[model samples]
Target chain A: MKIARHLIAAAALAAAASPAFADASTEAFVEDNANEVLESLNDPSLSRDERTALFSRYMDEFADIEAVSRFVIGKYANRFTPEEFERFQAAFKKYALAVYENELDAYRGNEVIVEGSTDRTPRDSIVDTKIPRADGQEMSVRWRVLKRNDGYQVVDVALNVNGNLIWLAIEQQAQFLSLLDRTNGSVDALINRIERMTRDVVAGRR
Target chain B: MLCFGVTDRPPYVDIYLFIEVLALKAGQAAHICCLQHTEVIMKTVVSALIALTTLTACATTQDTTDTASGVSDPFEGFNRNVYAFNEAVDKAAIEPVARGYRAVVPEPARDGVHNVLTNIRQPVVFANSMLQGNAQASADTFGRFLINSTIGVAGIFDVASTLGVTEHNEDFGQTLGVWGVEPGPFLVLPLLGPSNFRDTFGIATDRALDPLTWTEFESDPDLDDHIAVGRTVLGLIDTRARLIEPIETLRSQPEPYIALRRNYSSQREAAIRNGETEADPYQDLPDFDVYDEESAEGTGAGDQ
Candidate 1:
């Protein structure tokens, strides 16, 4: 149990402390969406609910929530029954959407610029972007863009810390797995935790 | 030993008294800047003043962009140098010993050591939790300490966690943050690595909170020193062993200093918020940096 906690923390710490590179189109995809999001956040015409609705629409269009859900569950993905996986994926999507919605609220009106990118594969790239704070300092926000048959979808957000890539999906995966470990790999337990987390986010308690 | 004939009072009382004096100094330091400016420059000036002796190791920079990554790294030149020095030391001395410790000690044994180390710190955690006005965390810490110390056989096993009283970390640094003390300038101590002005004082307060710091043995006067030293060394080895992969990953980064600075800020922010407002993706993770509670200093470890 201790090892599990440490390994997950290490993964998160490692990711937080690492950095990576991305491709051109990937960078454009992330940059355009990020700027648009900022524009929406800064627009005084839009009500809070309206902005949240737009954010949800953007997430639905830009994020591959299904692929990320499966990846986050790690080995347990194979173990879950088809029905359980479906239920888990739905719960996870709701949780992810709520989390991003809450997180995005804090970065209203911040200017996002694509610094550079590195394409690890033909279909995958890590785009490095910066959100300039009020103090003229830039906060690194790296997007992991993946090319789908339809178009490019964001799979993860890497907040570079200590030169490490703190990937959003990977961090969540550790948390999910840790919960599963404690609950003896019960799918229902994970679902419950995700649902609770989502509720917390929606209620502004998280 | 120096307190032998200086006072008829117990030696441990003198240690606590000394800590109280230092605490007074820290309070004064806190009053000077953290309470006034609530901005960057004043805090930096104060931190620089107090830590002047260690400043010789860091190259001073006049850049106004101290909070470049939204983190006040006023002494980045010094921090980077010390970071490099710590890496070299870890690579040369700590890393190899940690590797050896990992090779010799099984995972289960190491976990036992980790649990025991954590159990030992519960008192301090409990104290901070109470200070932070978190009744639940305070109760949980107390329960964990009582249960682990007894049923778990001096915390060789985490029976408290099994009983569903999960552990949470609360150091004096976090306590201070909760108390509205702004985290001052980002600092990288020679061996201690990443920290800030407010947390620096928090570290001292935490040590003062720990019973081990003031505990003494009448049968063998030197026993406390031996225990403290042994615990510090063992903790360093254990933490290094857990962080071998992560540190290597950090080394592979193009700009490690920037990465560390940004991440440290985020991590500290998350800790202070107690997982609210800031998403704590690593809440269950062990206190990688907090091993510095004693004289121990090293990076974190946990393999995937």
Candidate 2:
């Protein structure tokens, strides 16, 4: 009876180990969104404003902006009131969208090929990709996807720029930390700074 | 030996005293008092202290024997001092220059320079690949050099990559590792960061084998010096600029020294394995999927 039970357990383990049973769904999710962003950038009919709006919408759909904002705020997260936090989150999303929109505009004839996904945590997966440039140079990118109640959302994008892994969230965290330091660690100061930046982005000042 | 001699001296002295008393009596006692009492006591105390210290040192050595054997850094004390010096140089000079370079040069221009530099080093890489008996990689590297030099406009653009010839960055150090040469003692060279004894030799060999080192420019000493200095400075700036973000991240880790050491060792090991080992399972994943925006948005809205 014990032997039979052991055999059953081994069979179940083998079934789970199969490639088809791995996290293909999550990998597909990240790749699909990445391709959409690339395709939207390539669309000729869309005006700059239209393209920016479409990219923002895509970011909102795929990215957990609130989570990223809270994470970047880091240790100072507890300083904000409920209303202040909400405002900060909204402003952060706009600022992030503007930054990404500008960055993506540089993509001319690059192709994003998703390599695979690795489960970093039970609810998080890091999807790897290679962006082949027109000149034959290749860049690596990793998308950090979080499994929410509804589905997967991208929380961070890490680009291997010149062999250096530059994670967006971590970079933002450092920026926020320095900004807070410069403002005497005041949440109001940070909020005002973010608000001003968001306004500048909306006005196309930067 | 001195301590033992001191401890045994009292018995010998007593016997000598007894013989003296019988032979010379009280008349010669004053003459024999030349041996100072204070000097004898001081010698005994110093010898005793020395013996105690020797015992303590022995115990300490025994306690550290296990750790000493497990670790490979025989020159750790010297290496750490060198590491500190390198860190200071990087913070003061190298990092600031790299930052200034990044701020001044546009990304596209910087990448072009980087490509040109890499293309120039193809001959060295090809030679190492040949040494390692990797004919396919050697052919690819040679092909890349030829194509980029002609069609790619002096390698300012990587036209060879578009033609399906990817880069293989083989070096003499990696070739030596592939040939079963053990990585000798870990060393922290001043301004060079982490390296090993084997790699130090490898660097020397590679430099000697580089075709550029034996060029006709050597006949014109001034031109040779100019070329050498220019290449070194450009290469240093390019590498330091590329490493800015990664080094910052490494510095933020809890134990930067241990982190860097482990990273360097593991990366070298992986290079030697040539992606054959399953040391990193993530390297074997399939190509990424591309999704449509409408369906993704619908699902996302439903989830929220």
Candidate 3:
């Protein structure tokens, strides 16, 4: 009976401490990763090509490219066979790398300050951050981080768009799903579209 | 069993045997849960818009405190309720109609309609640009109107853009901001979305500046009324259609209210500053008209 009481007490204590731990760890994860990204961007020594490559490496390490690729397609993810899914995810990673290259370059010299964090679920957390501009203004950014067996992976980024709070993944879901819906749920169509977009970014057509 | 029919699912859903695979994964369940919480999520958006609108209405009357997002929203309670009302109306009526509009109208036709609508607003934009003494923007606005109106066939083709004249959005509110007038409290007017005290006055002035507000066609006075009402209705639908994805995506967020407030305020600030507020990653991307053909020409998968 004593052992049972001790076990219960231990379990209760662990549960009680879990959320605070999650918040702290999640905040730290974003701060470290974001600073790492900004460091590469702010590095005067690196050429544009070198910085972009470094940024791609950081995305590979910090972002769950596979999971995010899957998430963006939403329920239609099952439409792809293993080979097709692999193809799509690979193409998605390349597209994301290109998009983010342009994205991070805009913040080349800005500082990322992690404001705070909130645990939405036991495994899901959001880290709030701000990058103050040189002109006395600031931009708000939030990371939706999810915990996995390996470690934390960034699933989505939330930011303001025309006065609306939009999650990058969900926004992509809407866009991709709309295209898929129109193309009769063709994974190949999506893969091709993404590849063309990647080409455009690489070639500076957009 | 939350079984939304294939036709019934919102535009955000995949709509292709989605439910069959939905039960197979935890992630899918979470996405479904977000859809289930639509009304609750939208309440937050409503509150933010209302707060901004109320703030705008009372800018001269009340001493409003600035929120962390830099918006002064003094009447949050009243704003939230009004926002809720607006969201309910939007979901039940406006969005569905917009979706239907997207469905029946071909992409080119819709683009033409959007172009025409934008062209109609150029006179007002030009007025505000002149008010702010922005010579370049004024010239651009005037050139766009003159070119798009005649050569572009009543602004249906956006020939001005193709000619490299470009386009811009300027309003009396931004003119006030340029004059160093404060935004004064946030507000959310019912059915009009977000505003503030300065913007409310700006809205009124813009309305007065509109040629349609007072123009009486010598040929047909009744035609003028019809054109005015048609412009209002079509403009609302076009704007709503463009926003469905962004607003739907907003509902999936963890803190929609705060997100809306912060973002809305940030965007307004950016707009007031002529979009010189730090670099927006999503800015250079194409507009969120997913069904359009030329949308594929953009650099990224989505605007957001």
Off by over 4 Å in 1: A1-206, B1-69, B279-304
Give the candidate order by descending lDDT.
Answer: 3, 1, 2
**TM-score attained by model 3:** 0.49
What's the DockQ for every one of the candidates? 0.02, 0.04, 0.04
Q: B93-186 in candidate 2: lDDT tens per residue?
A: 9999988998899988988877787787788788988999999999999999999999999988899989889788766777898899987656
The TM-scores, one per candidate, come to 0.49, 0.47, 0.49
Ten residues in sequence with the least summed lDDT for candidate 2 chain B: B295-304
How much native contact recovery, as a fraction, does model 2 achieve? 0.00
- Candidate 1 yields a Cα-based lDDT of 0.62
Clashes of each: 22, 3, 15
Lowest summed-lDDT stretch of 10 residues in model 1 chain A? A14-23
Tens-digit lDDT track for model 2 on A1-206? 99999999999987766543447778899778877887787788988778778888888888887767766765455666768777777777777777666555444346668887777455667788887643344556788887889999988776643233345564455446545645666777777776665564445422
Docking class of 1: incorrect
Residue A139 of model 3 has an lDDT of 55
Query: lDDT tens digits, residues B23-89, model 1?
Result: 2222222211122212232344446456655764563544423232345655666676778888899
